[model samples]
Target: MIIDVLKNIARFLILSLLQVLVISHVPLGSHFVLLPYVLFILMLPFETPKIIVLFASFVLGLTMDAFYDTGGMHAAACVLMGFSRTHILKLISPREGYDNVMKPTVQYMGKTWFSTYALILIFIHHFVFFYLEVFGFSEFFSTLLRALGSTLATFVFIYIVQFLFYRNDKISI
Candidate 1:
């Protein structure tokens, strides 16, 4: 328990720094924005309680909001993402059903399952975030395209993060 908490703390801090200091600077054209920070929220242990997950997601988004000066968009999107995670998990779960797995990871869930899982959540998150960032219908198509592009970019980044840093412990839930 203590170790998991510490790991989460470090993950939050490290990813936040990467988002604000590094990835945020890269020019992915005008429409797309890189929000690798959401990976922290997505990669959270599958069994994490909803309240804790939502709270952690909010803090993570707010941290980024503070850096990016994007009003409350990040916080709102993250809270929504956190809230939706369990439903998405339930939606995609196998018949054998996540009973043996402790958390979602490429190592435990396999590449395809992890990819689908990441893609769904990342698309939802980016869809909400980009729409909220621009918040109007006049630019709807443009915003939609931006959101789509960012979703793909963010998905790739999330996968890379998992590939490079994720550890598979195979804990029984």
Candidate 2:
């Protein structure tokens, strides 16, 4: 129990630093913002309480907002994503229904399932974030395009992080 908590804490710090110091500077054009920080929220344990998730997400977003000078946009989007996480999990739940898994990872859930789950949540996060940043409908098409592009870019980075940093520990006997 304590180990899991420590692991999550470490993950949060690592991802936060990566977002603020590294990914934020890797310019991918105007429309594509890389929010790999969302991966920290998405990779949280399945059994984590809803309130805890929201709090953690809010803190994470606020940290980003402090760095990016986006005011509360990241916080709002992250909170919404955290709020919607439970429903999304229920929506995409497998027949077995998460009885064995603690965390949702590509290794545990398989590529197809993890990809679908990550893509949907990331899209929600990016869509809300971009819309809030733009703050109006005058540039609706551009905002939508930016959200979609950022979602794709962020998804790619998250996937790479999962593959490279997180290893499959389950052994086949």
Give the alpha-carbon lDDT of every model.
0.84, 0.89
lDDT of 1 by residue, 1-173 (tens): 78888988998999999989999889989766788888888778777888999999899888989998999999999999998988898898877887534468877787888888888888888889888888876789898898889988888888877777765454443
Best by lDDT: 2
The pairs that clash in candidate 1 are none
In model 1, where do residues sit more than 4 Å from their true spots?
167-173
lDDT of 1 at 134: 83
TM-score of each: 0.92, 0.95
lDDT of 2 by residue, 1-173 (tens): 67888999999999899888988889789888899999989988998888999999999999889989999999999999999998999999989788644468887787898999999999999999998998988899999999999999999988988888668654342
